[model samples]
Target chain A: MGKIALKRTSLYASGASPVNLLQARFYNEDCLVYDLEDSVPVQEKDAARLLVYNLVKYQRPVGKYVIIRVNGIYSEYIDEDLEAAVRACPDAIRIPKVEHAYEVQKIAKRISEIEKAAGIEEGSIELWCNIESYLGVLNAREIAESDPRVVALALGAEDFTASMKAARTKASLEIFYARNAILMACRAAGVEAIDAVFSDINDVEGLKEDVKLTRNLGFDGKTVVHPRQVDVVNAAFTPSKKEINYALRVLAAVEEGKRQHKGAVTLGGDMIDKPMELRAQTTLAQARAAGINV
Target chain B: MALNIKQTAVAGTMESSDVMVTVKPAEGQGLVIHLQSNVLTTFGDQIRATVQEVFSDFGIRDAEVFLVDKGAIDCVIRARVQAAICRASGEGFNWKGEDK
Candidate 1:
């Protein structure tokens, strides 16, 4: 669970579409999720799996994290999905509708077996668990800590609201609790928390506001359905110039304090402690990941 | 290898960056490929060579392969052909064994 690079936006491309798959890497999103779950038609499952396998194995995307979103844990397609996805060797495999820690463990076990059989380095492939239901949200912490392979827990609000039998709205008052619960769980478990997608692709303003809310709520990133939303999300997640400058000052003050053999670290007459230093480091890390000079 | 073409099967779409491949049993005829691509003048030979290589990899000597290419790359072409042949043969793909 060490620090990883910033993943501000994860874009979804239909697994069955060859055109989309080929063009996914050129986009600005930090992560590209080739979806094989809800996006592919039932009859086209085999076709989509083969296409994704070939795309990941032969024409793998460079300079971006690649993940394959498989079917639900209970679905019959999960086995075949894991088999092909593991062999394809993407950065991670995202499992949808995960409700329990055992589901994560079960899939991790299966992935381990596949990796062993395929001669792939064991524990190389990671997993991202999607929390789509009330149970999943309640058990988010356990799911996040279920296995070492579980790196992030993403909130799937569309399905969560459906599961709660509630209406979905633009303000997103309904999913507020679930969002916070997931964020806290990810923080407690020392894993990344991803927010749900903003479904209204046409409303750029609304999308920007939503990204603002996601960043304010301490989410690591947001799931984006379209390529156009990538820059919006990445911009919202990146640390601002003012914040980066303050972080640089904080780190410099800490270094100066160390050199002076001082007992306390201070910048601008305010006390700087461990948490503040860590936050400053994280801000600088995010800025660096965003390709800033700092 | 050792794929038996039991029936006609098709894979892929006619969209851009994709190729629609239809494989049919041509017992006596040896590997007949009818390819129509938008980039036929420039990439026709390369595309045909890719198909031929896939056929050789699958150890198929007799089949009528019909492909309508929309400027698909080599990987897409290879995937569509393998999918079509696997569907035609009514068998699961031995991905590890058929490492290309």
Candidate 2:
């Protein structure tokens, strides 16, 4: 995964809902995660699998990262889920409730076999792990470092809070440790960290603040349920005009310093060093990715 | 093997998010399709094309497909029809190794 643009909003559409899936492809979500795990009924899994496979094959998700959230490794349907997901040939596979490195390894092994047998270019499909449990948060680093195919680690708040016997709130003070742990592990492992979904669709203001918190907490983006929340997440991740201007100034200062043969320069009474310049460059990159004319 | 719908069967939901497909044995020759859709005028041709492709893939010579579509695309429509047909004809779904 060499420098793929991160989706500011990854909207999940039920793979079983053909109507929704079709409609979702037209939406402006940067990433559309077609879910086959919790959304599809146990009985409909087989049929839904085929439906997702065909949809991915036929539908060209232009300018969107198409990811299929396959069933958990422990589930009986995981084999079938991986088979359909790989054959569908989505851009990525999001493994739910990944608690151990072995889970990532297992999925990688299956993806490799399927890619070869199906004649897909090897390593073309990426992997995303979901840190949804206490164990998952604890072993997030190992799971993230499990394979090169793992590009992003998403936090599943509903399951994590349930596992910890804590209530999930709009303020989200409960899953603080879980979020931080995953974020730190991802940063250490050099993978993207995505925040969890905000379930209350009616509470727009609450969602706004939640997106702000995720962005403030260093998450790259959020996992959203409805299409309406896409823009909110996108705006939250995109660099503001003021921020972009400041970043530009910092880079200018760095260039000036290099021209003068000075070791460094200061901005806002703080040293504008390598790390700060890198952060500024990243902000500009993010602005570019979000289509903001920085 | 020329397969025919043995009974009337429905798969999927009529909800706004899903598509409902109903299949039954055809009383007359050829395929009869009565498509009820919200985007009937705009997407009618596409819907008919999708249903035709599914029927051709399954080798069904005669069947009546009554689709109450809630804006389902080709993929969901294909799955619902396949499931409904499998149920109507009393056959198992071997949905593996069919990917091209």
Best of the candidates, lDDT: 1
Q: What TM-score goes with each of the models?
A: 0.93, 0.88
Predictions in order: lDDT? 0.91, 0.86
Best by DockQ: 1
Candidate 2 residue A221 C-alpha distance from true site, Å: 1.1
Report model 1's TM-score to 2 decimal places: 0.93
CA shift of A128, model 2, Å: 1.1
Clashing residue pairs in candidate 1 are: none
Interface RMSD (one decimal) of model 1: 2.2
lDDT of 1 by residue, A151-191 (tens): 89999999999999999999999999999999999999998
lDDT of 2 by residue, A157-273 (tens): 999999999998888999888889999999999999999999998888899999999988889889999988888888889899999999999999999888999986987788998
Model 2: pairs clashing at backbone N, Cα or C within 3 Å: none
Off by over 4 Å in 1: A1-4, A252-275, B98-100
